[model samples]
Target: MAHNQFELLKQRRFLPYFVVQLLGAFNDNVFRQAIIGLLGYMAIDADDKALYTQLAPAIFILPYFLFSATAGQIAEKLEKARLIRITTAMEIAIMTIAAAGFVTQNMIVLLVALFLTGVQSTLFGPVKYSILPSVLKPEELTGGNGLVEMGTSISILIGMIAGGLIFALAGAQGPWVAGIAVIALAVAGNLTSRAIPPVGAGAPELRIQWNPIPESVRIWRLTRKQLAVRNGVLGVSWFWFVGTVLTSNLPVYAESYLGGSPTLYVFALAVFSVGVGIGSLLCEKLSARTVEIGLVPLGAFGISAFVFDLHFAQPVASMAQGLTVGGFLAQPGSARVVIDLAGIGLFAGVFVVPLFALIQSRTPKGELARVIAGMNIQNALFIVLAAGVGIGAQSLLGWTIPQLFLALAIANTLVALWIFTIVPEFFMRFLSWVLVRALYRLRVRGIEQHVPDEGPALIVCNHVSYMDALILAASIPRPVRFVMYYRIFNIPVMRWIFRTAKAIPIAGAKEDPELLRRAFEEIDAALADGQVVGVFPEGALTRDGAIAPFKNGVERILERRPVPVVPMALRGMWASMWSRRDSRLGRMRVPRRFRAHVEVVADAPVSGEQATAAALEAKVRALRGDAA
Candidate 1:
C-alpha cells in the first residue's frame, strides 16, 4: 500500500475527523468545568458537592448505555462526514445553551450540557473508528490508530487544563469565554468535517433504531457471539478500565495525600502522557511494521510491577507529609516513584494501539461501524467499573490513594495472567527464556524460547546494521533463509558470503517488478515447503542506528503465505564489528572480542490475527533491551 502519510494528515481526510473529535472533547470539558466552578462559588443548599461531583462521570457514561447501540448502526449506515458535521453543529448549539445556563447559574442546565455532550460523542463514536479502515492499509492502521489515540488523549488533557484555566482567569464570566472558545472550535471542526474523504455507508437503508436500550443490548450480545469479537472487545475494554482507575483517583491523591497544588496535577499528567507517547512511538520503531501483540503482555507486567513498587514507594514519602506544589519534585526519588504512572501509560500505548488496528483489520466490512459501536458500549461500561472501584475504595473501604494503587496493580497482574494462560502464545513466549550464562555466548530472552519448533515461519528483525542477519542466522539452531536488499546482495566483499548464505533479493515495487515477482514466488514456496524465512523488515541497516518502518514487501508476502510470523530481536549487534553504532561508522572500530557478546532473541510465532509490525516491534524492543 502506498504511504499517504502526509495526505492522511491533510485537511481533506484525517484532519477533519480529528478536529471534530478533538473539539467535541474540548467542549465537553469546558462545559463540565464551568458547572463545577459555578458550584464552587455559590454554595447551594444541595445535599453534598462531593456527592454530585462523584456522580458526574457516571451521568456522562449513561448515554453509552442509552445511545451507542443505535449510534453505531447509524454511523455504519449514514454518511460519516455529514454525521460529523451534524455532531459539531449540535455541539455549538448545546454549548450555547450551557453558556446561558452558566450566566443564570442554573445547575440543572449545566448537568444537561454534560449529558448532551455525551450524546454528541455517542453519535460520533462509530464514524471515528469506521473511517480509518477506509483510509489506511494493514501496516498503516497501527501507526494511524496510534497517532489518533495519542492525539485524542492529549486533547482530553489539554481540554481539561485549559477549561480550568479559562474559568480561573475570567471568574463568573469565564464560562462565557469557554463557550465562545468551544463555539469557535465547533465551527472549525464542522468545516474540517465537511472536507473528509468520502466514506460510504456500510448498511444503507438499515432500519433506524427507535429503541436505543434494547438495541444496545443486542449489539453487546453480538460482541459475545464470536471468539475474535469477544476477546478483542475484552482487550480494548481493559484500556479504559485501566485508564479510568488512574485518572479518577489521582486528583484526590494529589490534594489530600500529597497536599499538592494544581502544579502537581499538571506534572503528574505530563509525565504519564509523555511516557505513553514514547511507548507508542517505540511500537512502530521496534515492530518494524508488524502487529506485535507480544508487547501487550509485556506492558501488562510492567504496569503491575511498577504500580506495586509505586504502592510501596508512596507511603514512605507520604507518611507524614502532604505533597506541596514543590513536593511533586521535593519528595525523594519522586521521579522514579512515579514510574508506576508512566509505566501504566506506556503499557496503555502497547495494549491499546494494536487492538485498534486489529479491530479495523478484522471487523467485517459492512459491520465495522457497528463493531466500533459495540466497543464504545464496552469501553463505557469498563470506565464506569473503574470509577466504581475508585469510589468503592475511597468511600466504602476508606482506602488511601496509594493503597488503591496497590490494588490496581494486583488486579492488573491477575487479569494479565489469566488472559495469557488462556492464550498460551503470550505465556508460552514468556516461558521460553534461554539462559545460556556463558560470557562468550549470547543470552537470549523472550523470543528464542517462544518460537514454535514446527512449521514454516517468517522471521522479521529490525535492520540495525549489516551484521544483523548474519548474527541471527549464526545463533538460532534452525537454518533460516534471509531476504536481503539487492544492494547488499552485490556488495563487493560481502557478495560471495551473501550468495553462500542463499539470501533473497528485493527491489522497490516499481524499481524491479521482475525481481520482486521472483522474490515473492520464492517466499511463497519456502513457506509452503515449511522452511523458516528471515527478512530485514527494517529494509536496510539503520543509518542513525534506530529501527525503521518495515517495507511493504513483507506485508505482500503475508497476504500470499499467511504463515506463522516469528519476530526476532538481535541485540548487541549495533556494537558488533559488522554494524554501525555512531557517526564514525568505520573510524573507531572495536575488535572482534567486543562483538562476541551479540545475541539473537526470537519470540514466538505471532498469530495471523496479531502478527502486525507494531505488535511484533514491541516484543522485539523488550528483547533488544533498548529504550523501551
Candidate 2:
C-alpha cells in the first residue's frame, strides 16, 4: 500500500497505466487544437473556419454516443492490459490517417480522422477508470484518482499549448509539424501502453452485444442499479457539463471582458488548469487517502461560490480590445477574475474525483467497465446539452456572458442540493467528516491490515461518546452499519445523519422488546447481505472513563450470523465534549479540547465461533491500553 499518491507514480503497477492515459489525453487535445491551428494555414474565410470549429466537436463526440456500449462490452470481455494496448495501437493507426489529412490539407479527411479518434477514445474510456480499482487498494482509490485527474488537467493544458504553437512558430511548415507531432505522440502512448502489466478482465466470461442502441440502454440501466452508484455516475456527467460550459466560455470571456488577445485566453485557461491540478493533488491529503464523498458537497458549493463571484468580478464588458496578457493583468479587477476562474477549477476537481472513486468502489467488478461506458455516453449528452444551453441563453434570451455565468452558479447550487437530497449519504458523510476533523486529529493503526475490504464482518468497539460511530466511519475505509443506542440515534439534528447512514437503532428489551427484536433482525439481514455491522459491546456510552462490562447481545448476534469479528478501540474520546463525563456532572458542556489527538486502533479478526462478547471486549481493552 502506497501512503503517498506520488509513490504510485514511481511504481510499475500505476505509473505505466497513468503515463499511457496521460499521453492519450495529450494526443487527443493536441490533434484537436492542431486542426484548429491548421485553419489559419488554409485558404478559408472566417465563416468556413467557424463552421469547422463548430463541426469538429460534434464529430469528435459522435462516437461516444454511438459506440460506448459496444466499447464497454469489449473492455469487460478482453484482458485489461491487452485492451489498453489495443486502444493505443488503434490510436497509432487513427493518428496516421489524421497525419495524412494534415499533409493533404483535406478538411473532409481530417473530419473523418477526427471521428475515428473519437471512436478510439470511446473504446478506451471504460477501461481507463475501471482498471484503477483492480490495481489500487480501497484506501488508495482517492489518491490514485487524484493523481490521474491532475495528470489529465496538466496534459490537456500543455497539449493545447503545444499544438496551438505549431502553426504560430513554424508558419509554412506548420502542417508537417502538426502531422509529425500527433503521430509521435500516438507512438509514445502505444509504447507506454506496452509497459502496463497484465490485469485480468472484469468480466472475462461475459458475452458481447453487437447491437449498440439496446446495449447502450442496458449499460445505462446498469449504472442505475445501485442508488449511490447511480448518483455517482450522474455527478460525473454533471462535472462534464460544468466543465464544457466553463471552458467553452473562457475564450470569449477573456476577449470580451478581460480585453485580451488569444494569448490571454490561453493564460486564463492555464490558471484554471493549474488550480484543477492543485485541487486534485490536494484530495489525497484532505481525504486521508480514503474515498471521502464528503468532499463532494464542499466541492459543489465551492464551485458555485467562485462562479457566482466570477459574474460580479467582471459584470461589464471591456471597452479595450486586443490587449496583451500583461496589459490585461495590469488592469483593476483582473486579479479577481483570475482568482474566480482558478477557484472554480479547484472546486471542480474536488467535486468530481470522489464521485469517480465512489462509482468505482461501490459498483461490482463485473459491471464497472460497462457502467463507465454508460457514464461516457451520458457525459457526451451533457456536454452537447451544456453547449446548447449556453448558446441559447446568450442568443435567444439576450443574456450577457456574465449573466449566463450567474445563472450557471445558481443552477449548479440547485443541482447539487437536489442530488444531496436524493442521496443524503453524500451530505451525511460531509457532516461527519467535518465534525470528526474539527474535533480530533485522528490516527489509525491496524485498520488497513485487519479490517476486511469486502464481505461480511462484525466490528466490536468500546463506545466512549455519542460520536463513536461517526468517528469510526471516518477512520475506516469501508462503510460500517453501526448498532447504536436508540437515544443517541435519535438526538435532534444528529438523528437525520444517523438515519441517512442507515445506523441500526436498538432499545433494551425492558424498554421495547419489539424494537430490540427488529434491530437484531436488521443487523442479521445486513450481515447476511455481506455488509459490515458495528457494535459497541458495552451497549452504552461509558459513564466513567473505564471500559464497561461486555453484554451478551454480540454473542447472540454472532451465533445467528457467525461472521468474522474485528475488535476495535477508541482512545482519548472519553474526555471529549460529547462524552458522558460533562453530561454526568449536570453542568453545561463547554469545549475543553479542540482538535484533540485521537487514536482508533483495530486488532486482528477473531473467528465468529471463537469471538465471545467477553473475548472481544478484552481485545478492545488491550488495543485501547491505558489511553482511555
Question: Which candidate number has the best TM-score?
Answer: 2
TM-score of 1: 0.69
lDDT of 1 at 222: 66
Deviating ranges (above 4 Å) for candidate 1? 1-7, 45-47, 315-324, 425-628
lDDT of 1 by residue, 1-628 (tens): 4242334565355676766676666667766765676677667656667776866777788888888988888887887777777877887787777777777777677778778878888888888888887766544566667767777777777777777677678876775786677677777777767777677787887787878778877777766665545666787898788777887777766665555675676667767776677666566533334444545676788778877886776534455344555655666667665676787788778777766765676566678888888889989889888878888988999998889888988898888887776655443222221111222245455443555444688888877666555555544434467888898788774665556556788877778889988988988898898777898777778776567776666677788778888777776656654456643645545564243576667676777545776676676676667721
lDDT of all predictions: 0.70, 0.92
| lDDT, candidate 2, 1-628, per-residue tens | 7878999998999999999999999999999999999998886999999999999999999999999999999999899999999999999899999999999999899999999999999999999999999999888899999999999999999999998989999999998899999999999989998899999999999999899999999999999999999999999999999898989999999898888898989999999999998889888888876789999999999999999999888622266899888888787888898899899999999999999999999999999999999999999999999999999999999999889899999999999999999999999999998998888888888888889989999999998988899889987888889999999999998999999999999999999999999999999999999999999889888988899999999999999989999999999887676887768566534455556678999999999988897788889999999998
Query: How does residue 228 of candidate 2 score in lDDT?
Result: 92
The CA root-mean-square deviation of candidate 1, after full C-alpha superposition on the true structure, stands at 12.3
TM-score of each model, paired residue for residue: 0.69, 0.97
Clashes of 2: 0
